[model samples]
Target: MIFVLGMINAFAANPAPPSPVGRTRPPPPPPGLPIDENILTMMLVALLFGIYIIYNFKIKQKTPM
Candidate 1:
């Protein structure tokens, strides 16, 4: 049947599977934060800013309405 022939054709299309030895593997990433220093610095700044805002809110709340 045409279906059987189509299946055979599809299977035959890739005659040779690539062996692992045929291609080079990607180099391993360095051991450390995957992020850049600029990003890390920005994150730390944001954290400090958040803490500062929270502290200010707490102080205002304690002053009584």
Candidate 2:
């Protein structure tokens, strides 16, 4: 298409500026809580407890006379 060719020519005419070299960025902030096996175990236990509660409620609802 003419539009596509025109766009390609326009981009080719102007190139992007070169990036700065040897720039040192600041280090990222540390996490609030340390992630270890204890944290992982707690999360897994909470998820299983929530699933157990929901399953029991559904079973109770389906047991009508």
lDDT for every model? 0.84, 0.84
Each prediction's total of clashing residue pairs, residues at least 3 apart in sequence or on different chains, is 0, 0
Model 1 reaches what TM-score against the true structure?
0.39
Task: Tell me each candidate's TM-score.
Answer: 0.39, 0.38
Cα RMSD of predicted structure 1: 11.3
Which clashing pairs does model 1 show? none
Q: Which stretches of candidate 2 lie over 4 Å from their true place?
A: 1-37, 63-65
lDDT, model 1: 0.84
Name the best candidate (by lDDT). 1
Error of 1 at 34 (Å): 13
Q: Considering only N, C-alpha and C atoms within 3 Å, which residue pairs clash in candidate 2?
A: none
What would the per-residue lDDT of candidate 2 be over residues 2-30, giving only the tens digit for each residue?
99999999988967755657658755688
